[model samples]
Target: MPLRYQAIGEALRHTIAARPDADALVVPHQGVRWSWRSLGERVDRVAVGLLALGLEPGDRVGMWGPNSAEWVLVQLACARAGFILVTINPAYRRDELVHALELTGVRALVLADRFKSSDYVAMLLDAVPRFGGADQGSDGPCSELRFAIGLGRTVGDIIPFERLLEEPDSAPFAHLETISREVGPDDAACIQFTSGTTGAPKGATLSHFGLLNNGALTGSVMRMRPEDRVCIPVPLFHCFGMVVGVLGCVAHGSTMVLPSESFDPAAVMASVERERCTVLYGVPTMFIAELALPDFGRFDISSLRTGAMGGAPCPEDVMRRVCVDMEMREVTIAFGMTETSPVSFQTRTDADLETRTATIGTAHPWVEARIADETGRPVSRGKIGELQIRGYGVMLGYWNDPQRTAETIINGWLRTGDLAAMDDQGRCRIVGRSKDMIIRGGENIYPVELENFLRTHPAIVDVAVFGVPDARLGEEVCAWIKTSGPLSAEHILAHCAGRLAHYKIPSHVRFVDGFPMTASGKMYKPGMRKAEERDPTPRIPVARGSERAIKERLSR
Candidate 1:
């Protein structure tokens, strides 16, 4: 049956009614644990406080902080109070923060004092110069912004998070239930900023029904039980962590364990062992780091049974190791964009290794997917094309940008810019991005395919394939490799010699310590491509040495 929760507030109320005493949230690092009933009360208090702050329904509330109890409270409080939560990435610097605040017209911002090197207070003050001197509930240069709330230490003229929970006698606390009842399932719940690799980020507006159901379905696919505990290491600002990680646990009445404010391999391992977490969530790169930890074998991860991996292409080898080494036999791979409530395809828990690793599984329930050519017409099964999705999970549109929204969504189908192919069984395999595709001398080369092939090399730890300018071919393949030890371009070319097509072989290979990554853990290719273009180094020809010598060297 389709999900019937009218709003996230209603969903939380139902969960509390069903299992009030059950453990709901656990933040080990913060030493915070709350049952469903306690969590509901806290959410109500925060919602009431938000209302007291003069924010109206449909107002934008920006949250800038790492994963913590306060972050989760703000997320639910906004939903309950009929406000749109704009999730600001914790890694955003001054310029990016200003853009997000101004673009979304965020009325109130709730942020931390500092996370790592980012001082949220300093950045806000710099973005809006008058912020430091602005009176309580007064508008600043941003115009729409009315106030600021600090999660840690209270900055000058900025309210603290604890103050939000302290209800004033004059405040309309009783109206919390009424306001929550008025909020509808179709109302905008969240405006997530897309990780802008090409240009400026756009806020993807998602509805309460879309996010709630997406989380529920994701949890169901992972076979989440009421007794299960889920450890989330991904950032809460991203959909992978908030929607699939937090909401998934809430939907199943499972315990949510926050390993830390940010990604920490040791913290994750320790949380799983101490909390006895049955489910874990992360991108493939996170799993790679955890598996590579020097003390990885010391951790007792026997409690881990199922989890979800998304946010980037999951290497086959990583998937296999996660199953065997991490003991996540039921680990699934989810694939989608931020516009589609982040998950439209996920592997089933009972799926075989080939299905789990080779494909991104079938279309989610109540969701329709098709592989379409450039003309928007459906292509034949197994043919490569852009993947389009139509479902309740699709976002309402980009916030206040109808022009871009119309360009992206046509006749209710959201055009995911990703290039993919669908099998007869409806399983989808992402074949690089349409924009990321490299066309060299009329040959279309999918970087993901080449990257996957290069990953099989024993010396390569990670590789990113992209197109570099070529005078004759118009464009040639370039591979940026992160290797384990000393490796030359000759060794890499020799490995790709017979396995891949001549045109697909990387024309240029450069060794790098690490690839630039987005906050969401995806390889930031546009910057790398631009840097390579600016340098325009001379290409080294492939070494044509004795086949016998190459084979003998490869054996060692």
Candidate 2:
């Protein structure tokens, strides 16, 4: 496939011109339905509104919300206006939010007032002391944050989201068009923070050229078409949603159907039925939840022909069920990280079930992949080693951290930190992560980050966090702690309640006298992993669904 060296805004404009009357975006729960032309007009208004707020071309604008039409609008508007869109995870709590804002020096933040149990406005106010008050700002972090554009509901000093849509007295479209032309293909467009081996998350700076082409290629692999309606249940904060789900649709002029603000199994099936969606995107656990619904057979998801699944490893049984029961025979598995525009390898729809389930397919066009030994020499095919990639998809670098960037992306190759093996055919199977990162239900949770947070408790002397095999989530977080004071599992859970995201909190906790150590005196993580694997206890109670009933019957 030929690459398109266009900025994200350029691609959006092309699609709108070609398919102005076509359905562009739909959010069923929010009662949003828009055509390509309408979406384009709203995006432009938002862009000019952002400029009206004194935000320059290179300023950072943080998007802190779930999957909503407004979220999508902000994303494209930032790209069009040349503002770096910093995607802040909706699951993030106060500290994480502050870290992201401080790290990116976000000038404006677009946030939803509340989602489910998360009161985003309250959290933002708590995190940034200078947010709503008449103070110049604090001496601490997030001093640069000047605007909090509220979505859903307006409160206190938050600038209402609807206010941005109100037409200005001046000719705003011409002003926006002038600013849009200045955004180059190589300009930094997004800052997506991904947790590393270190405790803190690093912002991976991606360019318009890299993200546009990668999303285009991903859509190509899925055989996406202009008429295809895609059901996207993934979080928009991650690349899986913004890069692949949104941009991929833009590449083909396909309709983006957001099932709900957040992932809801029933909502997903409902949207697929109502819209006759041709494509669906999600992680393994999401598919599991959808299939587990008691009334799964009621939804006419026959409209689904193909989709993309990634983030965590795909289970063979689940893949088989998806092909047969769900009738998604053409569903493909994708592999990549935030640093590589989030997709370097994706299985083709034409491939057999085993090929799709067992391996991440050949490298994307223009992407170079190799399994390298410790000496940085390419290993023979079928040998397990470090998977490395060099490609147009690779990020410019981790934002503002040159030393760590040098350590990660050496000589143009982005160290994936994933242990993988390749066959002679160039198909790759991910063995494991060299850096112990836990992916719980599509959310990446770094062990060091959790361990560091747990250690902050005065009662805890040492803590170790790792991923244990989970039947549903692919992997769930497990932690072992050595405490200086009397501490129960309840106490540890309480400590992590508000401090960390729900998924990052450990599902299983064990109190240990001491940790098993290697000869070199490092913690022996493999030993702990093996012991946990032998334990017969279910990690967590399965929710009330067909899946739970089946598991209970099998256990009996």
Candidate 3:
């Protein structure tokens, strides 16, 4: 297929021309709805307003807020104005916020008054003391930061979002069109911060072509059409929501639905039923919670025909229920990270159930995927190795950090740091993260395999397996399990007895209420590993000589 070679602003213009009266955006809780034409007009107004604030092309504008119509408007406005939009996670604290601002050299910031319990205004004041006495639209502590804009309410000297919408006496509407024409598809349009699970977050610079095309392709895989209404409950700051959720809808002329400012299972169900949303998006944890609701059956999710799930592996049981109970028959499993426009592999709508659940499908169109060993040589098919990607979806580089960018992207391919195996048919199965792999007595163990096996037990609801420090063996297998009812470590070991290999059986097991989660709802394995290191609790081990005994039993 030919690539879409236009900038995001141009794409939106074409969408407006094609479907002027169709619903383009809907926020039920906020009582906001805009059709395609009206949404385009709003975006143009914001673009002009931003330019009126003395902002110019290539400036970095930071947006820190939850999923809302204003967030979507800022995204489009930045693209139209030829500014690099920097997305900040609403969950970020003072240090993270400061780091993001410093790293991107953001010239302006737009934020909400608060999200959940976070007093964003207070945090900003704490981070930048100059804001205490600075006038509205004046430079603050950071010399490059020209102004600050608040969405819901004015905070100190920050300009209110409403002011940006007001037409100035000499509005730069003509200049907005000029900038749109000058902006190229390869121009840096956005800088999104990585989750920073390992250390400090790095800004991944993405071009207009990369994001718009990725979203269009992802939407195409789900068979999205103009009539489709997509309910997006994920945080807009993440690529999964902004790139795949918002841009996906825009690319296909589908209506974008914001269930709530933040993720709420009840809100998602209500939005789908009320809006008759045909498409949905979320991580596996979101779907699990929605499925586990006490009154899950009360929601009329019959309208949900297709959707996408990513950010973590989707358990087989959860996938099955999503298909049957939630009526998302065409729901697909997407796999990728923030640096690659967030999706490299996505199960096609026509794929078989086994292909959909057992693998992450094949590489996307115009994208290449390969499994390579440590030295970066391609491994033979069906063997486990690091999954690397090279394509248009790859980011320009980590913003302003060539050293780190060179480390991640070598010879044109981005090292995903994921351990995966590909079938002869090209389907890829992510076994485990390279960092999460366990080495016990020189034998490598993939936690996902064991975790999947452990989940087979009727009492187990969820499981996360990782490596724990061991003096004898470099690392030992440890499992954290969430169960539906009472379960003993002995019972877990017995269940694994003859089914799995001796070395693969978890060396330790701990029952827990739930696993720690990241903002995007994926299991926070790094945090859990740190907690395990601190506690170092004595765990139940396999029966003495049980390994050899189980090997002999399985051999029979």
Compare the candidates by TM-score and give the number of the best one: 3
Q: How do the candidates rank by lDDT, highest first?
A: 3, 1, 2
Model 2 over residues 344-456: C-alpha lDDT tens digits? Answer: 99999988876786688889888999999988899998987899999899999988899889999989999988888899888998766776767777876767556656766
Q: Which 10 residues in a row give candidate 1 its minimum summed lDDT?
A: 538-547
Model 3 vs. true fold: TM: 0.96
Stretches of candidate 2 above 4 Å error? 134-138, 437-556
Find the candidate with the highest lDDT and give its number: 3
Ranking by TM-score: 3, 1, 2
Q: Candidates 2 and 3: which is better by lDDT?
A: 3
lDDT for 5 in candidate 2 is 88
- lDDT of model 1 at residue 326? 94
Query: How close to the true structure is residue 177 of candidate 1, measured as C-alpha lDDT?
Result: 76
Off by over 4 Å in 3: 134-141, 169-171, 538-546, 549-556
Clashes of each: 0, 0, 0
